[model samples]
Target: MHLVYHNLRRRLLKYTWFLKFLAFLLLVSTAIFLVFKIVPLLLKFPVQLVNFLKPPQSVLRTTSGRTNFILLGMGGAGHEAPDLTDTIIFASLNPQTQDIVLISIPRDLWIPSLRAKINTTYYYGEQKQLGGGLILTKASIEEVLGQPVHYGLAINFTGFTRAIDLVGGIDITIPQTFDDFKYPIPGQEAAIPEANRYEHVHFDAGPQHLDGATALKYVRSRNAEGDQGTDFARQARQQQVLTAFKDKLFSTQTLLNPNRLLDLKQTFSAALIHDLSDAEILALVKTAFFNPPNLRSGILDTATSSGLLTHPPVSARYDYQWTLIPQDDHQLKDYVRQLLFGQ
Candidate 1:
C-alpha cells in the first residue's frame, strides 16, 4: 500500500509538470503569431511611405551623383492634340553646391527617323494608347541632347492658365510690341466657326497686368514683332513669365494666406501631371523658399549657346519640317553639360 501511494503521487506530479509546460508553450506560440502575423496586418503601412519616410530626392539625380529633370508642357484634355508637348525644359540642381540651371528646347526641335518632333513624342505615344507620354518624351529628349531627365512635370495648356489665375495673375514687362494674326482660339474648333474663333492678338511693350489667357499668349506667341516673334524672343518671354510666377508663388501674402494656398493647391493638383507626391512637393517648396539658389537660364538655339544646333538645309523633306538638329552628338552633350552643371 505504501508503494502504490508513492507511484500514484509520482504520476500526478509528472502530469502537473507536463500541463504547466504545455501552457507556457501555448503562450509563446500565441505571442509569435501576434507579432509576426496579426500585428503587421493591423498596421498596414508600407505603400504610403515616400522613399520609406526619408525626404524625397530630386528625380534628375543619378546613383552616380547627378540630378536633373525635364519639364514638358502639353495641351490637356479637351484641347486639340492634347498630348502634344509644346514646352520642353531641362533643369539641373546640384544639392551639394545649391546651383540651379534651366535650358529650354524649342518645340521645333526634331529627332531623326521617328517622323515625330521631339516635343510630339509624348503625344505620339499617347495616340498609340500606350499611355506614357512622360516616358516617351523623356527618352527622346535624352536621345536628342545626350542628357537624361529623371524628374519631370508635364503641365497642360489649361493648367498653365489656371495656375496663373489661382496665383491672382502674373505681372510681366513686355520688352517690345508684337502681334499674332494666327493666335489659336481655344475651345472646340469643330464646334465653332473658323472665322469667329481665330482672332488677331496684340501685346504692347511695358509693364502689364496679365490674367491667365493674356499671360499665356504673352509667353507663347511666336509670331510677334522683334524678339517676341523669334524663337529666342519667345524663350525670353517664357523666362520672364517664370520669374514672375516664382515671385508670386513665394510672396508673403500667398504663403501666409490659407485660402490662397488651398486654392493654389486645388488648381495645381487638377491641372498638372507629375511624379511628385504631396510630401515631396512640400519638401521641394520648402527647399525653394528656405534655400533659394542662383537661377541661370539658356536657350539651345541661340547663337551664343555653343552653335551646334542648326536648321536643316533647304530640302523639301527637312526644310518644311522647320526644326533644328544637332550637328554632332559630342557638341550637343558638351552644350547641355555646360548649361546644366555650369561645367
Candidate 2:
C-alpha cells in the first residue's frame, strides 16, 4: 500500500513538470512570433518616410530653440514633376507649451535677391544641389522673416491630392462662386488643356462638400469672388482645407481604425518630405490632438510686396521678386510663444 501511494505521488509530479514544459514552449513560440513574424509586418507601414529620404546626419541645422518651420507645397506642372513651391506656410510648435502657429507666405511675393519669383528659391536650391529646393526656400524665408526656419516639408501636389483622397475627401464651405479657367490636370503639360478643363466652378457661397480634385480646384482658383485675386486668397483656402482635414482625422471613427491609420501613413508617405523622424512625428501628433491651441491665420501685408524683376545670368525670361516681412520680429515671436505656451 505504501509503494502504491509513492508511485501515485511520483506520477503527479511528472504531470506537473510536463505542464510546466508546455507553458514554456508556448511562451517561446509567442516571443518568436512577435520578433520574427509580426514585427516585420508592422514595420512595413512606417510613418518615417522623411527619415528614410534624408538620414539625420545629412540634414542641415541652425541654432535650436522654440522656432517656426515652413511647410511648402510645390505644385508640379505635371504628375511626378518637380516645380517651384506654389504654396509656402510657416508652422511653429512648442513641445513644452503645446502652442501652434501657422502663417502663409504668398508664392508671388517679390524677393529682390533672387530677382525671380518668390518660389524660385526651389530652383536655386535644385541648381546648387544644396538640399534640393527645400533648403534654398528655407533660406529665402529666413531672410524674409529675419528668423530661422528650423526645418521644412516640401510635398508634391499629386501626393497632396492623394492624401486628401485617402482621408475620404474634405468638406469645405465655399464663400462665393468662382471660375477657375486654368486648372491643370495631372499628367498634362504646364498649360491647362481647354477640353479637359472646367471653365466655371459654380458652387454657391455656402457650406459645401468637396472631393480631392474639386478641393484642389477650389483652393487654386484665384479669380473667384472674395479670392483677393491673388495667391493670398489661395493660401486662406488651403488653410481651411487643412483645418477641415485635421478635424476629420481626429474623429472617433477614423482614429479607431488601424486600417485607416495605415492607409493615411501610406498616402502621405508618397507626398511628404520632412526632417522629422517617425518618433518625433508621433510625439507631435499626440500634442497637436490632445491639447491643440487656437490657430491664427495671416499673411504679410501689401506694403511688403516687392516688384517683380527678371533674374540676371540665370534667365532673362524668368522673373523673381521679394517681399518685406513683418517689421516687428518680437510681435511674431511673441505670438508664436503665446500659441505654443498659452492655453
Candidate 3:
C-alpha cells in the first residue's frame, strides 16, 4: 500500500509542469473572452451610432397593443446615395406572449407631407443635421402607422458588413440565379467616371455560404435581370439575409463560442443605434431566455396584393418624382395593425 502511494505521488509530480501549463492556458483564454466579450459593459451602456440619443421611453401601447420598434437601414457615408434609407421596417414584440413580427416598409414610399420618399425622410433629416435622423424618422413613421414606436435601431451598410463578418459569416438560400452587371466597384478600383465603375456579380441559386461582401451584394444588388431587378425582389433578399444572420447570431454554435460571442457583442454594440438602457437590455436577455420569441415577417411593397402603387409626379400636388403611394393611408394602417397585432 505504501509503495502504491509513492508511485502515485511520483507520477503526479512528473506531470505537474504539464498541469500548470494547462491551467495557465485556461486562465488566458478566460481573461481574453471576458475582456473582449464584456467590452460593451466596460465602455458604457447603450452605444449610440447617432447623436440624437435621449432617455429611453417606455414600451408604447397602441390601440392594438404594446411594444413596437422602427428599424432603418442606410448606405451611411461612404456608399452611393449615402443618405438613402435603403431599408425601413418595424418590429413589434410581445414579451408576455413571446411573439415578434417584422414588417418592412418600402423605400419608395411617398410622403405627401414631406413631398419626398418616406425613405428620404431620413436623408433630409440627416442632410439638415436634424439630430441625425432618428427623431424625424420616428415621427414620420408613427404618423403613417398610427402607432407609437418605443425604440429605433438604424444600421448602416458598413455596419451590416462588419456585423456579418464578425459573426464569421452567414448561410442563405438564393431563391434563383441572378446577375448584377452594375455593382459599383469600390476602393482604388473605383472608376474615375461613375458610369465606368460597374462590375458583374453572379449569385447561383440555392444555399450558399456567404462572407460579408458576398452577403452585402446579395441583398443590395438591384441592377440585375428578370424578377431579381425589382425593388420587391431586393426587399425579399434583404429579409432573407436578415433572417439568416439573426439565426447565425443566436445559433448554438455562435452562442457556445466564446470568441465569436465576444466579437459579435462588441461589434453590434458599436454598430447598432438604440436607446435601450442596461436594465432594459438585461430584461430583454431574461425574456429571451425564459421565453424565446417566435419571429414572423411580412413585406409591404408593390409586389404584395395590398401593396403600394406607382404614383406619377403631379406638379399641382407638389409631387416631383416617381414614388409608391398607398391608396388609403387609414386602410393601410388598419391592415398593418391586424398583421402585427391580430386585433
Candidate 4:
C-alpha cells in the first residue's frame, strides 16, 4: 500500500510540470503577437493624435521660393465703367527674406493685343466668363513682368470704405495740402450741368484720421494741383492708405474682438474676389507672424527723363486714347526685375 501511494505522488508531480510548460508557451506566443501586430494598433492613436496637433503648412503655391499675387481695385456699382480696375498692384513676397514689394502697374498702360488699356482687361474678361477678369489680369501682368503670377485678388471702392469704417477708420499723414476741383461726384456723371457733375474735395496737410467716405475721397482725388495731380502721387496715396489699413486690421484690438472679425469677414465676402483657399490664407498669416515683412513700393510712371514709360503721340491707331507705353520693351523685364528683386 505504501508503494502504491509513492507511484501516485510521482505521477501527480509529472502532470503538474507538464501544465506549467503549457502555461509558459501560452505567455510566449502572446508576447510575440503583441510585438508584431497588437503593438502597432495600440500605438496608432497616439501617432494620429500627434499628427492632428501639428500646425498646417505647404499650402501656398510658390515659384523659386517666391509667392506672387496680383491685386486689383475697382470702382463698384453706380460709377461709370464700374468694372474697370483703376488700381493694379503686383505684390510679391519672398519668404526667406521677408521682403514684400508692391509695384504699381499703370492703369493707362496700353495693351496692343487687347487694343485697350491694361485696366480695361479685367472688364473685358469678366464679360467673357465669371472669374475670367482676375485670370486675364494675372495673365496680362505676367506678360508685362515676364514672370509667373501665382494668384489674383480684387476689391471694389465700396468695400474699401466699409472695411476702413469697420476698423474704426485709419490715420493718414498728408505730405502737403492738396485740392481736387474736378473730383467727380458719385451718380452725378450725367448731371445737366457739366460743372455740377464734380465736387471740389480738399485735404489739409499733416496727420489726420479719415472715415470711410472721406478716405475714399482722399485716395480717389486725381485733379489735385502740381505733383499731387499725377497718377504716381495717386498710387502713393493708395499705398499709404493700404499700409494704414493693414496696420489697423492686424492690431491687437481688432484681432481680439470676434464680432469685429465676423463683420469684416462679411464685408470682405461681399466686396472682395480672389482664388485663395482658407488654408493658403492661414499660411500667409502664419508666415507674416513668424517673419514680419519689410515693405517696398514702386510705380511705373512717365517721368520725362527718369521713367521706364513714356506717353505716345496722339494717333487714331489707339483711338486717340491717352496712354503710356514702355520706352524700351526689352528694358521692361529688367526694370520689373530690379523693382522686385533689387538685382
Candidate number achieving the greatest lDDT relative to the actual structure = 4
Candidate 4 local lDDT, 1-343, one digit each (tens): 0000011112222221112211222222233333343346447866533432334234567776678988787788988789898777777878667776666677887787777888998998999999999899888888777768998877777876887798899998999889899999878989888998999998998999999889888877879998899876876786677668767876887767767766766676677788876455545544554556676654433343545456778798778999777756657676566656667
Query: How much is the lDDT of residue 147 in candidate 2?
Result: 58
- What TM-score against the true fold does each predicted structure earn? 0.69, 0.60, 0.70, 0.73
Best of the candidates, TM-score: 4
Task: Give the alpha carbon lDDT tens digit for every residue of 220-274 in model 1.
Answer: 6756655567766765677677668767866786667766665655555565566
Q: Which stretches of candidate 4 lie over 4 Å from their true place?
A: 1-57, 170-179, 202-209, 224-253, 338-343
Models sorted by lDDT, best on top: 4, 3, 1, 2
Q: What TM-score does structure 4 among the candidates reach?
A: 0.73
lDDT string for model 2 (99-174, tens) is 4455556666555566655677887777887566777787777765555787777666666566567667878786
* Per-candidate alpha-carbon RMSD to the true structure: 24.5, 21.4, 17.9, 27.1
- What are the clashing pairs of model 4? none
Which of candidates 2 and 3 reaches a greater TM-score?
3
Write down the worst ten-residue block by lDDT for model 4.
1-10
lDDT of 1: 0.59
For model 2, the local distance difference test gives 0.53
- Candidate 2 matches the true fold with a TM-score of 0.60
Candidate 1 TM-score, true structure as reference: 0.69
- lDDT of all predictions, in order shown? 0.59, 0.53, 0.61, 0.68
Look at candidate 3 and tell me the lDDT of residue 279: 47
1 against 2, candidate with superior TM-score: 1
Ordering by TM-score: 4, 3, 1, 2
Decoy 3 TM-score against native:
0.70
